[model samples]
Target: MMKIGVIGISGGWSSEQLADAVEKKTGFRLIVDFENLLLDLDTGTVWSGGVDLSSLDALMVKKIGAQYSPALLDRLDILRFLQGKGVPVFSPPDRIMGVLNRLSCTITLRNGKIPMPPTIITENVDLGLKAVETYKEAVFKPMFSSKARGMEVISPGLGAREKIENFAKKHGMMYIQKKIDFGRQDLGIVFLGGRYLTTYARCARGDSWNTTIRSGGEYKPFDPSLELIALAQKAQSLFGLDFTCVDVAQTPDGPVVFEVSAFGGFRGIHMARGMNAADLYVTYIQEQLDKGLITY
Candidate 1:
């Protein structure tokens, strides 16, 4: 029997559905909170009170939740250990950090030769305002967050910087970037195995940047521009990830890299496309098992 391990058993609506769907599709029972199976480094024996995750055929670190302290963020370390021991982990732990943060995502896009809007991320409000002044159309967002929690557009002469500073003072620093004047719609490219699994776009009626869930932004299938497809593939390869959803915006300059969600949502995409992301996930896990890459 193929055993698969998943994280975040109790949180996240989409991941919960994905886990249940995975079991139905693959017939592989999932063990949640498998990070509790971590081994004591010096002893080289597994920890207590959880499934023997070391025996699972594959593992998926379902978008980890916010850890208030460093000690609470041990799931990634466990995943890395499993990977080092030849277990093929989904969205590899290192890659998780690579795509989760806005700054890291932008940096990766630049390093991978992907196109992106000019960006300015800082704590200084004056510098941020200057960037908005320079670009005339910019977006200010939280440095580390999901669900477009604090995403806002800054038009010319808008007194958004002061508001941003006030928010920043309460939160942390903000990462701001020039918003692309992309006409009409944006694309959400879900990729697996370094290739495009689905290429679709979403269009908002008016004043919308996010297009999948959380914003009531409606979507229709789209054929990605060759450039956007190529960039997405390059990013997947660079991260060496098993699955990723790369958000791209079409601008006059071409496709601009927006965000890369490592632990992306699936119910909306599945509901829209009538394809099961959970099934795809299971299939990928089995493929890894067949190759003898995953142990346990």
Candidate 2:
């Protein structure tokens, strides 16, 4: 039996689903929580619940943390260390790091000529206010966040400066983007091993400003055009993640990429398309291990 470990939150839906899939395939199940991880540099060992993670055949990262935070970067560094020790980690810590910070991800996408909403990133409250004024309406987002958490829509006038200032005080840097009229929906284009797998749309419910499930949104199956898939493929190729989801919005100008997810959502893919992404992902890992492609 292959001993495959999963690094994720214990009670997380996606994490548990992935562990179940791995157990079904390899007859071994271990969900390694970062909180319980003990990395001993002197011994070059990473222990979690008495299991040496470095001894696993392969490790999969379903979710690094329950929420997005800079602390998650430190967790990724631990994975990078494990990878250096020759444990095959899916998605590769380096690639995940590339898309972890919103600013870094945006810079990479812009450098690759991927179209995005008009944006500004700065620590200056004046500039943030100016951005809101310029766009009339802008969304202030944390550099490290998911599910629209800590995101605020600020329109010019009426305590706009105070809003930006308060956000900047908490986050240090503000990522403000011109709010695009995306018809209250956006697409999550999923890819596995750099190949297009499926597309799901998140439709905002009622008066929510963001199309996140936490914001009262629901996922639905969507069929994207060939051009849209090509665009998403080009965007995901920049990071070369083993599994990723590209958030894109179709605007009057065409499709513009929002961000390439570090850990794509399994629920959206499953609920919308009825596809078992965890099973497919585990199978992909097994194939890579069989091919000897994940050598240290």
Candidate 3:
């Protein structure tokens, strides 16, 4: 029995399915809440819910929804400690943070010469307004959110300044992007362990955000263009993530990346394409174990 530690048990259909698959493959799986984990200083002991995390064969980060708080920093410290103790964490805390920080992703993609949406991150409201004017329309997204939550599309509008101020006040910085014209659909490509799993286009419901696939919105399975595939693969490598979904949008020029998600959910794809993300992930874990590529 391979003892594996998963972050949290997120209650959703896809998560449930994935959990079942992982359990069936590994036999023994442990649900760990990094916040609930404690570390002893002198003895160098790490315990969570009466289970010593150091004893686990492997640590898999799944549902670690932490923010920029002291507790979250402490959790990162614990993750580093686990790595120092020779326990393999599939997506280390730094890689996870890189994907979550919107600014970091933009810089990394831009530095790598990967095309993405024209983005502007600013602490000053004036610069933000300039970016909006430059693009004539912009989308403001939180640095640490997904599913299009806490996002507002700001064009030349009456309430644009208020929106910018409110966002700056709330998030301390404004992360804005030039909205792409995808004609209502944007590609969402999933990759696990550096291998492609599936690709689907997230279609908007009426005038909704193209990246979001939720109620009334839908996703359809399709073969992305060769350029799209390469872009997604390159982003997966640049982020150094074990599993991720690369969102891309096509303009007149070519396909531009929207954002890469480190903790993307598969409920939308499960409902639309009927492809199982959990099965792929668990299979990858098992393969690593079988090949002795990953160890405790």
Worst 10 residues of 3 by lDDT: 65-74
Mark the regions of model 2 whose C-alpha exceeds 4 Å error after superposition: none
lDDT, candidate 2, equals: 0.93
Which regions of candidate 3 deviate over 4 angstroms? 10-14, 66-74, 214-216
Candidate 1 vs 3: which has more TM-score? 3
Summed over model 2, clashes come to 0
Q: Give the 10-residue window scoring lowest on summed lDDT in candidate 2.
A: 287-296
Per-residue accuracy of model 3 over 213-286 as CA lDDT, tens digit each: 54356877778877778888998789878888888888887888877887774765676689777777777877
**What is the lDDT, from 0 to 100, of the residue 224 in candidate 1?**
68
lDDT of each: 0.69, 0.93, 0.76
Report residue 167 deviation for candidate 2 (angstroms).
1.0
Between candidates 1 and 2, the one scoring higher on TM-score is 2
For candidate 2, write residues 11-63 as lDDT tens digits: 88999999999999989999999999999999999999999999988899889
TM-scores for the candidates: 0.84, 0.98, 0.90
